[model samples]
Target: MAPARKEKPIHSLFAGATAGAIEAFITYPTEFVKTRSQFGGKKEGPITIIRDTLRTKGVAGLYSGCMALVVGNSLKAGVRFVTYDSLKHKLADKEGKVTPARSLIAGLGAGMMEAIFAVTPSETIKTKLIDDSKRPNPQYRGLIHGTASIVRREGISGIYRGLFPVMMRQGANSAVRFTTYATLKQFVQGTMRPGQQLPTAVTFGIGGIAGLVTVYTTMPLDVIKTRMQSLEARSQYRNSFHCAYRIFTEEGILRFWTGTTPRLARLVMSGGIVFTIYEAMIKAIGGREDEQ
Candidate 1:
């Protein structure tokens, strides 16, 4: 008998990265709006914020941190997909079949890696652009230009202003998101019984629930990340921890969840889209395996 073909980690990584890049590119303006709204103020709504940002910063402003977003999101997606697959396989080997909890664990590991390596710098640049309409002296025309400007002015350290909060938020967010999705999928599959397929509406419903859960759970860390990244040199808070402490002390606990409304909305919409797309991709790829 022929040896069984093994799934390649790199293939999954590349595919996920490509998908993530596309998704990020498409939704980056919303992300820009989300970040700005998160850090800016409670007064202006999302639409108003977007309008003001475009009026002041123009078209380029909408895509202020495109490069950083693309690169960071790509790496994050690559690491997340690859790590999740590898860890799931290993866990399955030991425990027999893959389970939702196991998938969550895998996602946690992937999220930590991505947060530490990919989220910090990109977020820093993004936050700077969003918070400040004063186009830097020379004006950072694009992501590359902005990154270079940050590096030149602030040194290597500047690129990671909100590293800690990002790590904490994304780690927990990814874990819960993946776990909920996995568990929900299992629950849906179970109801259907042997050889049954879950309906599309059911899939979307489960994904939306998982997304809401993650957003609420990770709101505080997300607030801290946005605040830290938005800081200027003249600003008080020096780092993520300090920012979190200051916000808690000054603004109280509720301050940490300032943008919960928009964030929850964004998470629900984005999460549903991402999972649906991921499922579709997996099915397409897995089908080829079955045919072979």
Candidate 2:
């Protein structure tokens, strides 16, 4: 295919939304398992997690808060890419080349914006649904009821229980992700002829690699965020720092990486799928970026 035409900011947003929905639907089961595993101390591996979840809640259990997650992710993705692109435009040099620092800054900003606006509240409900699934009797039937229940019990602030950790996790996540992605994408394009489109497989591979790097670098924060959010009350760890301290002292430092396997699998697949779909959708929508 020929190089795509230039794109506007709105194109990035739309492409991100489309990509988010597609990736979330496909990888949600892994996400559910990852969250469960993050609680740590259960000898159950990913396979057992899947088996138990299936046995108890059925296949639908694997998708408990899917719609809420999907919608939230859709909005978050849009905001993330849009903010990144806008920041990139401002930060790029005269030749329009973005340094690693600038790219990371843009990604951090994008992640923070998305986390504050969409991720915190969305994940609050999503985690509640997932946590509830293990209960003998699930309290919230679905997304709507779950949201209402949280508000009723905890008030508006309830939905933002893990806001600080979420911001930190997401900030680090996108910063590493976009920086790696941009660097790899540049290398990939450098190897090809001018105006030649990257193959779909290559795009996915690069995205997968970026996702892996992002996950490992930010795994500790991610674990803390999950622990903070998963609890219905503040009884367990107190705050993010205390959570980290307790997990370190009691569970050992390794507990910070409790969910690495499922998370790695989910994120790698999600990154590849999301990036591939995002690029394809952007191209289809007549939104294009200059060959870097």
Which candidate gets the maximum TM-score versus the true structure? Answer: 2
Q: Which pairs in model 2 have colliding backbones? A: none
**Candidate 1, superposed: residue stretches over 4 Å from native:** 1-7, 40-43, 57-60, 93-101, 134-138, 193-201, 231-234, 287-292
Q: Cα RMSD to native, each candidate?
A: 3.7, 2.5
lDDT score at residue 26, model 2, on the 0-100 scale: 90
Instruction: Please provide, for model 2 over 167-202, each residue's C-alpha lDDT reduced to its tens digit, 9 standing for 90 to 100.
Output: 999999999999999889988887999868999999
TM-scores of all predicted structures = 0.84, 0.94
Task: Give a tens-digit lDDT track for model 1, residues 192-223.
Answer: 75656666667767878998999888888888
Question: lDDT for each of the candidates?
Answer: 0.72, 0.86
